[model samples]
Target: MGVSVARTTVATKTGEVGGTLTNGLRVTLGIPYAAPPFGAARFREPQPAAPWDGVRDGTRFGPVAPQSAELPGAPAWRPGDEDVLTLNVWAPADAPGPLPVLFFLHGGAYTFGSSAQPDHDGAALARAGLVVVSCNYRVGFEGFGHVPGFPDNRGLLDQIAALEWVREHITAFGGDPAQVTLAGQSAGAGAVVCLMSSRRAAGLFRRAIVHSVPDATFSPDLAAGLARLVAEAAGVAPTAEGLLSASPQALVEASDRVVARYAADPDSGPLHYDTVIYGPVLDGALLTADPLDALAAGAGRGVDLLACHTTEEYRLMHQVGTMPPATTEEDLARFAAHWELPADLVDRYRTLMPGAPVLDVYLALAGDGFFAAHTARLAGAHARAGGRTRLSRFDRRRTRPDGTPVRAWHAADTPFALGTLDAAGVDFLTGGPADADDHALSRRMIRAWAAFATGGDPGWEPLDGATGAPVHVWAVPADRQEGPAPAHALWHDVRAVLRL
Candidate 1:
């Protein structure tokens, strides 16, 4: 695929926009999916973007949602940049007619991240015979913070609006709207499952791919309580008017303070371990039930689903220093108690991995608790509900030139799935540089994603709901595995005990 820079134009529902041609793909960025979610629209449901008079510039990525963290190769939030609810598109420059569409949502624990991330580049996926779309939705407090007299899950509403835009105008980009596949990672993955259960998002897409869905959601009361913390930290009331009085930057700072406080207090429960302050809120109207319960009840039976999680999902958090170390039995017990795991959970994990360090045991258990288990449960629920589902796990690992080991941690699968292992900042996740085998694994992963988006099958058999067997494990030399992980045998016991 020869790379070139050429102007390309596409007509959208809102207006005509120009994009750049590169690597045999047409890349359009920063097209508004909804009106700027600020000013009169702050903390409310999304509103449609005003139609432009002529061709709009879609050459640059939009500003990210209100966040304090700076990410690699992605735009950061500026105080006055309100046009955050935008979407981007990538399509084969010369598609025969209509191709499958893969709409993506980037993940940063739902508090940070943007579509402009280097690894999120959709050129490779577009070249693989899919029209790729990614969007910048509100994150942090602006997107999830609770306020009286306002709708909850405004970020999800932005996503629904973006999908609606794709359904209405994707044909102009040579995409088959009927074949749209909704895909996301981490918080983005959490949003994917939440949307799957949401009636407001029905018919927006035909398939769903979620990687490492977080085992987290907030009740209305919890959300409101967090909102008050932010409000008090920002020196304002908890009401909508008071919150609106504070700037996005103020709330971002305040949320960081709350996270720091939680991190310092071991008694703060799960938040003390993973201090993300926002997630999908279970409001009675928009989100009435837990996604797991909703899936078990046949909520998304009509959509094809593909789910994957890493073998060592929580390793990245520990490596990045966000998660505190669990070096002692007391530390491990504290973790189990914080997450409401069964009293014997620590002993069970120790039994599963004899001679392992307490930290390793804690990481394994925490990995399952936060990501792997939830992802597996989602597949089981969807399959049991009669949805076509394929389950997979990324188990690739390597030693860097310096002999530092890298496990297949939380997001180690994304660059491979998106065919961007060489993207900037990805080396830290994949370990040093990509070798021949790594590239081959990336190609296979990308193929599975493309195949799944085009058809229902992802080169693997659909999961057998009863046994949940035949999982496709993605590794250097990929292999098919039967039955769940050994530690997973205790998931039922743990979940029953915690009633999660």
Candidate 2:
């Protein structure tokens, strides 16, 4: 009865062990409730795992889902493992019941990242008296291929499986499974939207927080074409038999390269929003309908929602390619030329940001186009759907590569949200702990998230049209507050009425 439960997952269905860490925090590692999703079972709905003979060793993490590029995280390689359909749990080991449950989905554009990264260690969040969970779902074609006979969204299914596991077993670890918050960033955010609309996800969790939902998607034809792209790249014949036999690495590379090529020039490239084919699509199943379409239709009216985006959404993207010599005025003009921006809007931006270089403008434009708008849309849709929505912008920048100060760039808020700032103390997704300024905001966010999970409100002003308070900006008190952004956030109206 005194066995410490450090790791619990769907792998073993339902069981518990506990342990006190050397640092005084309780930890739980790898406990499974679902069967492995490898070999012939791949591309299918998740199945429950078989029970083990004796107490399983959960001191370490389980194998993460299949991903081509391993971001700086979780146990990518593990002994005695293969399939990546596992999840990790961290708690105070013996934290009391009715604790808030926070289920985290790491972001990587649906391509890279695993639950194994140090950036996602939930022990800190758990110490906050909340139950924490991190999961690894299939990525790339293995996770989201619209092939002839394959499931359209393996990644989404993997998420559902993990949440379902939480529903069934989280209580064993002192978590209030009913009061569950499904939170994610980027593609993970997109998955939150999917979960909102999926009937399978109902009752699995109570509230949702979708951070920087990319709103990345494709049309049916485009999705089919992307399948073909994945097939051709994997050296498969677009037939089920062909792809079924393809190597995981080959498929992963094919998908990643295709996405990278298109992401290079999303507006000019094919499958990229205005360009060409890429990202999750509006398949008849899996998603039931496109999130934008569903949101407009009041599809997720019953779900509570909180959404946000970083101030500098494009800076993280700079890692993708080399920015030409720090961006000049001429460079900005060319970018505007390439994207065909409205003349007035370009002029307004030039006037609004006179001190910034052209490259910064372009990057800002990309951020708004890709991340900010989508977040706004999510909040607006939920508002129109008779659901309450709380919105925010993570304003604090990050530490530079050499430990300098960089403005809040893209993906900067993640480290704080996951409580991993120290482990990944870099610009991309790590930094110092909450200072008085950062802590004040993190307190609000953590509470809001917890409140939303328990109920529907995020403890902030509601985002109704009349209030005019579109979002709460996070920062220190004297300088940190919500609302009153640029003209775009003020002028543009995003309603979620049924379109389809």
Best candidate according to TM-score: 1
lDDT of 2: 0.67
| Model 1 TM-score (2 dp) | 0.97
TM-score of each: 0.97, 0.85
Estimate the overall C-alpha local distance difference test score of candidate 1.
0.89
> lDDT for every model?
0.89, 0.67
Provide the lowest-lDDT 10-residue window in model 2. 491-500
> Where in model 2 is the C-alpha error above 4 Å?
1-26, 77-81, 259-278, 319-348, 397-405, 425-444, 454-458, 466-470, 477-479, 487-500
Shift in Å, residue 465, candidate 1: 1.6
Pull out the clashing pairs in model 1: none
What is every candidate's alpha-carbon RMSD to the true fold? 1.7, 4.7
Error of 2 at 315 (Å): 1.1
